[model samples]
Target: MLKKIFKQTIQINQIPKYFLASPKPNFPIDKIRNFNIIAHIDHGKSTLADRILEMTGTIVKGEQYLDKLQVEKERGITVKAQTAAMTYEYKGEKYLLNLIDTPGHVDFHYEVSRSMRSCSGSLLLVDACQGIQAQTLSNYEKAKDNGLKIIPVINKIDMPAAHPEEVAENMQLQFDVEKEDIHFISAKTGVGVDGVLRAVVEKLDPPKADINKPFKGFLIDSWFIKDQGVVMLVQVKDGCIAKGEQIMSCAFKKRYDIFEVGILNPEMTPQNSLTAGQVGYIFTNMKAVSDARVGDTFHKPDEEVEPEQGFQEARPMVFAGLYPDDPEDYMQLEKSIYKLALTDPAVHIYKESSAALGNGFRCGFLGLLHMDVFKQRLDDEYNLDCFLTTPSVPYRAKLRNSQKILEVENALMAPDDGLVEHYEEPLAEATILCPKEYVSAVMNLADERRGEQKEINIVDEKRFKLKYTFPLSEIITDFFDKLKSATQGYASLDYYHSGFREAKIKKLVILLMGEPVDSLSFMVHERRAHDFGKNICKKLKEKLPGQQFTVAIQAKLGSKIIAREEIPALRKNVTAKCYGGDYSRKKKLLERQKEGKKNMRSIGRVQIGKDTFVDILKN
Candidate 1:
């Protein structure tokens, strides 16, 4: 029966023999460790995971199996959190290690937070050379808040510039750990990694569980598969979940039969049952994309259990429009986005139509990196090309008559200036870690972006941490890139929404041929409205195709035009046929052509191609 089910689910050429025959091991709760590795980007979390997998005989040594997505391979970053189960014999006893490898980028903080919930401990990896970064600190705080036992592991100790001693000292101050508590290892070369593994077995507490209670679990993550509906990675908190069992989601309130229960030993290996303290995947009869909530709790249909405290839904911070280059691909793109959103729930998608770009979906993401990665995944995984518009943040508008507040995520959704009492923009508190030498540059960059310094602390003799609060709109666009540029790529930033503040902001509208383009309109501060209008008008003048008549590009604030530019009409010499004709005949031909151009300008509609928007949006 297992073989038959495997045959139905497997899309590959052939199913692996071991998947069909591998015996399930029922390890005791005390012998199991549920933990995750958390660190900043490029801090060697995946490398350390690979080493751990190899040492435990889960897979080959050089296989970077943690990051399975194509975008991850191309970008060399983990965009999603992945899990692996390993069997290791420590001393004379065997232990079951369930490890979740989390992304370090701040854009995926939701992923990190969700992964942390299923684990009882975390390996806080830090780079020896780069010291502590802003994300590292942020992740550390999350781990602390989750009540996870954190092990300070300093990686890349073998590098030429590596200062394990200094990094350890900084960790001591930041994390309040003793000298002996810190573990130094080079993840690349595998030096002292074995000791780190031993530390995991010894220091980290096993997950607290009781198999005698009713079956209960919460989904840590989930993804859709072609042949097999939705596969969920769940952490069983009590009792057990088995194949052919009827389970119901506490959140969705829908029942599903467990088609298969398995653990990813880096690969899907079927297990008879997943008990308390075990992290494994469940195959269900869920076909709808919305059926599998990422953090929903599940329980036996016959039992009444209190629902677990599931994760708070991720809120999108940045918004952008994603329209297919060809309108026919809209349905396909919509399907692809729904499928992708299963794995990434933070992206908020809604139907939006643009006057400039036509039919598309306006999507919201956590940050710029999240938006870029989502688009790249669409291209790489789904073979879909999308025309993306300028990213904007959600703004608040107040109606003057009723004093009702409106959330304006898309520029088209924003009300006219007269309809508002005032506008309030979202603010974010940014935490930056940088070398002291670049402090002045960082400060200047922050000041230029209307940031107010909140606090500055010296991390060490040569490094300091700067905290600033700025309008979320300011940092959502190229602020991190500019920060890196000013700090010579040595600065790391992490931020969180800091509520909304009133500001002198106005809606900047772009009109083409006397018609407003929804995609080109945006909200800007009153102080920078003129310059932004001028720049946008200039950019449109260059990218917009010339029409039969002169095309007027104008940026308007309320009733006043702040900036204007014009594109010359594509003209043809109507009088070319008469080389030696009378001057009056030539003059009459010119006047007729001019009248035709004028009539065309008044009646004709300009069509902006996908390439034009792409060029204008490119940085």
Candidate 2:
């Protein structure tokens, strides 16, 4: 039954002939070098890639082709993993180089992992000024685990404070790489970049795969294009795949007739077939976005081969409710989210409805930046205005009566206190790198976030690495910003899921004028509930406008109030018309005014404007 559905394909004649060019002359697989560039954020990975592209003439000068996303350009960071295939003549022989530029931010670690899986080696770039950082170590470990050869390179050698020799020694001591293998280059000035590229051709081993074997490739990344349908980036592991060939996904067990095969020369260039040890793209003419999943293996339909191992599913660390700014745009928002999810399978979305927010999706992300990028994409690509609730982490709750466990992604989905037997919150192991001078500030900040010190290692006299275990919930909100501010933007952080631990947690609920507001509620540690409640109530008090009747704002844990604040009512001149009347008439007017105030207190509904919600979230 599934085979029939998987057999669907678009007619081959519909695609342009330019997108299905003739097969190239067979080249020895030994001449191909598939590698990726990895480093800590702001360590010049993208800059190095630009230089490589220029030196090889794959992209013309003054062309911005790799960092195509607007967000990446605006922030000067690489968020997406992009591939560029270049042909360079080295040592009097033509060699094919497949270079994948990966994201450095921890939020996009999954993207880096995928890029690593497709490569035979990696260029481990480090900033000469900053030395080794948290992500540099993290990415090194990832490369090592993949059994890929790592070539350490020191970047920014032209800077005034450049310390290439010192950084090379540190890399040798920390990573155990020989000093002779370290390459120093200035990507900004194109100095020594030629040596780095030459080293790649000489040092990195060519991809070892048999061309005679049945066709098998791993899908490293996938996204949807308007007319192209689902375009998948694939790394050929064994044999060859050609246009119009029948292929099947080992993970989804779905079949597809390849509509097009191409290579990214910083732009999509058509190719008839991709043999073993090659990296390129394949269009399956798949209409559904969910059909092409990252990390899935594709092979010939007749041959049944085991899928590649080491594919880790992306787990969302932060969850939040996303609603349309206008209630009437619910359907439009849903469609937009679906479209966005097609491109970003890391984002988990499900239908959710709220009394205050109307229809929305409970979306999950890798971290705060991941959520922000997803929201930004929705606005930029779909032109949809969205309202995002405060981000929260997933918590495990046990029902008191049935002992049934529930995964609570949103605070609103949490079971009532009476129904919950106990709760366990997720914890993470964080590794922080900072200069020795700011060690005290980083430690103090970690302690304030309820982080427990596990170990501290002095990398050198000037820098150190500290390991701490923290509640994932605590660090998901404003912790990264605080860490940066505390260290003057010199600290770097990398973390992974540790496990779940029992926590003394309480649901902090906010009530406005005797009515509970679900949007303002949160789950906080019991010890910090009072402080959090007080802070939130104070913020709300300052944001809410004065009304005719006094507005009571209270934060409660179950039935007990932890903090309370009141917004004073606006004063009205109700007795001014009685200037010429007797004292008895004035007294009557005062009585009427007092009676109206009493009635208003009981019936007035506190209206929370959109701007007020935005302000509260920003605070």
Candidate 3:
């Protein structure tokens, strides 16, 4: 009878006192602050977040989480956005601190932005010594537009050449914010963490919500554990929410019987009714997670209307053509993509038919890093082994006579010579901010990759802004790697698609022996046709096995195969002493290798081994 009474006492909407500190009848929501820690990759966002979490006493002292998952800790970057509930006692009243930690990489920009929508303020972390980079400014602008009050925090204060003053100065000169507004802290050493915590509680106060009415909560994130069933991490905005009842996800209006409503101390604990300015988890009967999305809302059983535009569908900005390395794994590949889509809805895939590669699909993303993460997720999470073709931007073209609109990703899909009257390729307005001594080096590097100088502004004698128009196709290629190399990693660059422009580009196919190797084909500008073919052939030559007969490689324009090379034949008489066995056995082993080489289809005299395509498309 006592056990039954205790179990029944914790209602569906009941939240524990720890998760949501119960307010008196007159308490207001203005004492709360909801914000996120954001920045470019390796800008100390995660370390700083740890400091805040430690300082606020949400987690114990000297108990660093390393983040919530293995992947996040191993990569040293935030893979997803996570919200933690913390309380700060300052000036007598306890202020609630709800902090969201986000990924700094550009690939997860949508996730970062979506998380930002829930935050009323953002702590913009920047590396003190490295100064500001491209992604830093981009996320900063996004947080600003989301109505998030900006608190610039110059991280890594303990570094040898720490430049808190320089980064502050750069923030003032570049982004047009007051230098005095930013905060400097070493989340690593827990330096100045108190100031950060106090500032968050004092300066960035919360938005108002009426708690006297019925409950309305926002589901910031939801997941399914193998053994635990379905779980939701939610933020209660108004009134009170209870467990043991049915609730609906505002994004889909899908209902679930609330099994339990609780707090997460790295684990969920049953609690009572959750009220305004609170964060907690809810276990529900809905298992598939088809109804919920990040940034979704949860409401009382009766509310009908959803958010105006529906849940904003995240669209991938970068697209890459993908193929199963071994055609037999097609079913495996399909299942892998579908499973990954469960957690990451942004990875979009569509069926594609290519003349060279045949049946395949095009995967879309926000950027190259986004594409890399998706592909890596397939390999790491889903265990799908596949080969990727060289990535290229979708090109827009029209037929000369019929004027048919065509979007081309694979070079082989590009129409014949006379068919294309005009083609427009995507262009990016790129910005490179760097020191004056490296400005010439950056400019030369940009020029080498076919960038047109748009403008150049001298910020100071030592700092300058170099603007350029670059092809999106170039960006997906090795352009970024080259920029990093040329600038000695000093130049900070950022580029966004401006629009499409007329392009003088053509498809260049690499032929092994006399037949084309489909995956090696790429779109190359008129002047770069030879260079593109040469680079691919050079990499392929190193990867392909040696053959009995001379193997030739050539650059082809469809039916016309031009520019050729040959891998010289194997020696008729190899050294007998090299092998332990007799000459005949050594000859047989060599003969087997030669047979394997012959079995592979050759473009002319060039033979491509089975492993020729691995990491060929990667940097």
Candidate 4:
């Protein structure tokens, strides 16, 4: 009887009547502030978000808040943009605040862009000690581009190295932000976070959306949930959407009946309707995952609205092959990739097969870190063992005979020399902001990577911004790491895609035992082809284990072998039994061993193990 009563009590507590039913609160549009927090990585973006949630009582003092993703917790950085709706009472008046905490890494700039579009204002947080960095300028520009009001805040003011006044001056000089408008606070200690929150309510203009118009919302982010179909986080720009309403996507031209409409109190809370100027989520009972896109527009079936402008489809800049370690798990890996792609629309993937690696997906990402994050999520979320090939950037090749151009993301897709003319590699305009002390080192590093200086602007006596245009292929691999190292972690870099430029690019192929491996081939600049071939050959020679017969590794440009290395066969002690015998006997034993080795080499085939492939790719 006691156990039954206890179980009943627990069940009752779990099912709140208010939570089960939809909430019907009508918030004035003029009183709602839809904004996001923007900052450089490790400049306390997440910490400040936590404080905002705490101050608004959206979450309790000790409750675990944003940075909810497991990978985010481990990395101590925000990977995805998370939304939370909070109601703050100031001077006896209640105001609804919709906050989006976005990732600071340059790789997730797309996420920042989408978040910026959904908001009317932003809190531009800067570190007091570190001052303004590269991403600070990049994110600020994005917010400004979206016409969002920016509130400058100096974070980490409690630290011993805190220089709030200096950072404020830098902001004033670099961004032309008025010094009087800047706020100084330590996000960790909640010193002045409340003031920042109140300022958000006072300074930023309320969302200017027409609630009387037809229901139309911008799908800022979306993902699939098990048993729930597709859920989209949308910012209502006009009118309202409610649970059980019929909605259609303007981009996909698909219709669905909404299963639920709710606000993210960090967790989805059922709401009767999300009115204009409010940000919330809608669950469509549609199983087709492709119907929902990040930047697509959704509206009621009876009311059609023009799709929002400035919403471009996310394009993948880096390409690689993702294969499972175990070939039998190919289908599982494919399913995992599909599921992950549903959540991350920026990641483009299609089926691919390799002779050595079996079936996999040809995956494309925004950048190197984006690729790594996708791979890491695959391992951590889906529990699949995956192997990734070397990353490459997309190139546009013009055909000589037909004058037709083809965009080739994979080297394997490139046409042979007989059909190809010249290749145009993608170029990106990169901006590096760093201290003056490390400018020379950064310049030298950029020069080594074939970067052409475009311009240089002095920020102040202590810092400056360097602009350069580089082949995306050159910096896609290790350029960021080198830049950080050269600047002693003080440099921050941002880049955007520029148009393609003609280049002397050649396909560098790696041949194992005389057979060319298509998976091992990559495109390289003609000037560095020899050095790239030599380096890869050396790395492969070290990675490939000794086989029964000598394995010859060669790097080739067309039919010409540019670099060659050999892995010696594992030798047995064939002459060990002749230790007590004469020198002639030992020579005879060695001769017999050599003859056997030669026989083995005649028909031997070198087998490249999975570890060898991983090592080569990692190097």
Question: What would the TM-scores of all predictions be?
Answer: 0.88, 0.89, 0.76, 0.88
Give the least accurate 10-residue stretch of model 1, judged by summed lDDT. 10-19
Which regions of candidate 4 are displaced past 4 Å?
1-24, 512-514, 543-552, 566-607
User: What are the Cα lDDT values of the candidates?
Assistant: 0.85, 0.85, 0.70, 0.83
Cα shift from native, residue 289, model 1 (Å)? 3.4
Q: Please provide, for model 3 over 276-335, each residue's C-alpha lDDT reduced to its tens digit, 9 standing for 90 to 100.
A: 766678888876755667667777778543442323555555677777777788788887
TM-score, structure 4 vs. true: 0.88
Residue-wise C-alpha lDDT for candidate 1, range 521-542, written one tens digit per residue: 7789988899999998998888
Q: In model 4, what are the clashing residue pairs, if there are any?
A: none
TM-score of 1: 0.88
For model 4, residues 1-619, the per-residue Cα lDDT tens digits are: 2233233322211222232222235688988988999998889999889877766656655524789777788788888899988887788888889999999988888889999888889999999888888889888988888999989999887789987777888899877789878877777766667668788999888888999999989989887787667788999999988887899889877788888888998788888888999999898877756677778888888897988998776688999888888889988988888988877778888888766667888888998888988888998999998888888899888898786999888888888966778999999989899899999999999888899999999987888899999999878888988998998888888887778999988788998888888778888888889999999889888877788778888999977999999998898988766658578888888898899888888888777776776677642
Can you rank all candidates by TM-score, best first?
2, 4, 1, 3
Candidate 1 local lDDT, residue 495: 88
lDDT of 2 by residue, 1-619 (tens): 2122123322222323322222242457999999999999889988889878877766655534578887888777888899988887887988888999999998999999999888889999999998999989999999999999998898887789988788888898889999888877777766667777888899899988889998889989888897668889998998998888989989788888888998888787888789998899998868876777788899998998779987887899898888887889999998889988888888889998766556788899999888888888888888998878888888999887785899987777788899888899999989999999999999999989999999999888789999999999889879989999999998999987778998987788999987889888788898889999999899999988899888999999978999999998887887877668579888887788889988999988988876777667531
Candidate 3: count of backbone clashes, pairs at least 3 residues apart or interchain: 28
Model 2, CA-based lDDT: 0.85
Which candidate's TM-score is highest?
2
